[model samples]
Structure formats: structure tokens, C-alpha cells
Target: MSKQPQPAARAHNGETRPSYSERLWVPVWWWPIAVAVTMLLAAEIHMGAPGIRAWLPYLVLLPLPIWVLLWLSRLRVEVTTDADDGRELRIGRAHLPVEVISRAAVVPATAKSAALGRQLDPAAYVQHRPWVKPMIVVVLDDADDPTPYWLISTRHPDRVLAALGLGTASEPEHDKT
Candidate 1:
């Protein structure tokens, strides 16, 4: 694939330039589950059936394990600086514009703090992997979009935050009740 030149983004009225593009894929830890499932399937076929023909099917279905891996790995996320002077987050087949983003924060990798995947905001547009470490939580402007926010996993969350120009100011303001 051809690499696009990094572009300067107007983030919260300030210019934030992205230095490089990165694609985040499925974490390495999930592959073992796929292998286990495939092995279980093979075992079921081998022990349950009483004929020699039953084992023959396992050979034909040898690619099933790889297929499972490929399916899980299909969600590719590309973060880059576009020529339109906007930071882009290309997750799966969707492209999210980071220009109108209002807030961004880094989520910790601990069990209680790793609020990713199904544990995140239901109204949010999320693309998360359980095996990935820290995640980036981005809140978009509610006026222009249907998705309330986004929860994405990234290996280099600091760079992703930099690309979005989300510093300490990205934190939400709490009411003094």
C-alpha cells in the first residue's frame, strides 16, 4: 500500500501534526483460543464417529483453524494524518474523522480499568480487542454524529493522543455540585 504524507490537523484550534501511520490488529493472545477451538472440533469428529471416513473429513477441514484466526484478525485499524489536514482513524471498513473530536483519554490496562469491548459505553462506536493493552477513548461532538464516542485499542496510545491533539485539556469538566 502507498503511504500518505502526514498532514497537520486543526485540533481544538491548535495545530497537531501526525508523524506516522500505524495499523492496529488483533492482539497475539487471542490466537490460542482459536487453536483450542479447532482442536476441540477435530477431537469431536475423531471420537464421536465410528468409521474411518470420519477422520477423512478432518483433513479437508484442516484450514478451519486458520480461517478462525483470519476472521478474528480481520479488524484492521489504520491511524494516519490525511492531506485534508485531519487525523483519520480507519477501523475495519469505517473511517472516523478526528477533527471534530471533543475529548480523548487513555484507559489503563488493568482488569478493573480496562474498559474496552462490550464493557464500554453502549452508545459508543467501539473497535476494541481484549488482548491489546491500553485503549484510547474518544468523545465526538454530539451535534454532527450518531455515535456518541469511540473506544479503540492502540499499541502507541501516546502517539494516538498526540495525533488527536488531546492533552490534559481533553478531560471533561465536572460540575461543582
Candidate 2:
């Protein structure tokens, strides 16, 4: 039996550059489920005791975090090329269009954390896996909305930049002064 061939890199204007997009999903651990279950159980136990019935409203709010997590997990980016124009880009339920993209590039790991205006949270946080950096950030070409940047966690930052034609040789020369 012959093995199936994998999809080849997509070509744009005779140049082979695959479209790239990264989706943000919840870590594939049982933690979300465990948290949901623990909250349910704790709420049940708290409500079971006498005189705690008055606090039922608070107990009912225990599931809010789980709902939030599920909602966030559904957030994803869909990157593709426009067959007619042949411009590669990504779109999502909540993202600006690729046509609105002004710049894209791989930022060194240290700069990535700082550029996002994010602080390392010691308690609980999502730290990009070391192997995933240097991560790619795309600055969108919008003025009214102003801040339109995407700090995507990806292993193939170069491929992503190439696909969008944002990592051109001309860009680096300007930064080397």
C-alpha cells in the first residue's frame, strides 16, 4: 500500500509560501474539567449545610469561570489566501482582516513579553513555551482602532512572516542603524 502524500507548501505568485495562522486554545490538560468539578462539588457541599441557603446566589456563580474558559478556548484564527488577489492572511471571529495588516515580524522572546504590555503573573498565567519563541507579532494597518497587533505563539515564525510577505529583506535594513 502506498502512503498518502502530505499537503505541499502553497505557492503565491510562483513563490511557494504557505499560509500560516495560530489558534489559541486551552491547554490540553484535565485542569479545566477538574476545576469545574471541584467548584461544583464545593458549591454543593457548601449549600448542603443549614443556614447557607441564603448564599445560594454566590454558589450559583461558581460556574462562571468554567464558562469563560470554554468561551476563550473557542477563540481561533483562520489563515488563508484570497484565490483572486493571492494575498495570504488570517481572519477570525474577533480579528482584524489581513488586508488591514501593515507589518508582521518575529520578535525576540524578551521583547514579546514586554511589547504586549503583559506582566508575568506568579500565581496563574499562560507563559509561551520556550520552544515557541521567538513569537511573531503582526501590526495591523488601522488608524482609528490604533492598536492592532497580534502576538501569536507559533513554532514557524519565519514561515508565517514569509506567507504574509511582511518579512521582506528591505525591512531588516531599516532597523540596523
Candidate 3:
């Protein structure tokens, strides 16, 4: 598939499609949320000493996870192609190209936890699991091997796959008499 976006394509009959780097660095607050929550948890451990004041600092940590959840809810995906044939997956500096990816797909309900090595979510109940590292699976065409896959974990799976022009394989047809 062609990597270039249509030159004629316009965002709102006025705006143009963002360039590769511009698209890549757009910040999603989810990263900060993840960072903050981690810091809060660490602060709790540090402050959990032996005095009555120790309890107050840890109590402040209770809301850290909630902020992470809210940030996750607002997550976004930004995708683009690199200088080579590889594709770039981004959500605020967290990027992975096709080479780093072992597999990708619009994981089906029947898809197993082969990636995770354990079952937790229905997406994980299948053969491969995402290992809790959420990713969108993109099955590629014209690939050399059977694993024409690029796995990227992003909050916006649908948008990421659509931007890359990748998709899942169609099931085989049944034989008739």
C-alpha cells in the first residue's frame, strides 16, 4: 500500500494532513497520568514511616490511580510512516515501528492470549495475550513471512489502524458440495 497521504485530501476543506513528525509528538495526557500515579505510589512508600503524620501522605496516594484512569479515557493515537518501509506508532513519544512489532491485528473475540502468556480479559482469553501492554494488531499485505504483523498498544485502536491502512485477514470460505 502507498504510504503517502493523498495530496488533495483536506481535513475540513481547509486544513491539510499533518506531517509525520508533527503527528508523532502530539501529546496525550495519558502519559503524564501514568507518570504521576507512579510517583504518587512511590511517595506513599517513602512517607509510610512510623509516625501519625505518615498516614496522611499515603491517603493522598489513594486518588492517584483515579487520575490515571481519567487520563486513559482521554488517550489518543497518532500514526505515520518512517523514512524506510517501516510504520511508526505513537502516543506522545512512545513509538514502535513494524520491525519491533512481532504481530498486529484487530484482535477477535476468539483471539487467544499467546502474547500475554496468561488470561485476564476476553482479548487475553484467546491464544495470545497483549501481556497487559495494550496494542492494536495490524495484519499486513505483501509481507515476506506468515507474521505480517505489527503490534502497537494505544488507547485509540480504530483510529491508529485506519491511519496506517492495515486490517485483519478475512476468514476462509467453506467448501461446497
Candidate 2 lDDT, 93-171, residue by residue in tens: 3334456777777767778667545642332112244434566667666665545466666656776677676673333
Model 3 ranges with Cα > 4 A deviation = 1-62, 68-75, 80-87, 96-104, 118-135, 138-150, 154-159
lDDT of 1 by residue, 1-177 (tens): 112443434354455433445555555666777677776777777886788867765775667767766787666556555455666765666666666678887776773253653466777777776667777777888575677778877777777777666763344789999
Instruction: Give me the overall lDDT of model 1.
Output: 0.65
Clashing residue pairs in all predictions, respectively, total: 0, 0, 21
Over the stretch 78-141, how does candidate 3's per-residue lDDT look in tens digits? 5555444445655443444444444455544344345333433332212222323435565444
lDDT of 2: 0.55
User: Global CA lDDT of candidate 3, please?
Assistant: 0.46
TM per prediction:
0.65, 0.49, 0.38
Query: Candidate order by lDDT, highest to lowest?
Result: 1, 2, 3
Candidate 3 residue-wise lDDT at 82: 40
Runs of candidate 2 with Cα error greater than 4 angstroms are 1-18, 30-66, 94-102, 118-134, 140-156, 167-177
Clashes of 1: 0
Report the lDDT of model 2 for residue 5. 35
Clashing pairs in 2: none
lDDT of each prediction vs. the true structure?
A: 0.65, 0.55, 0.46
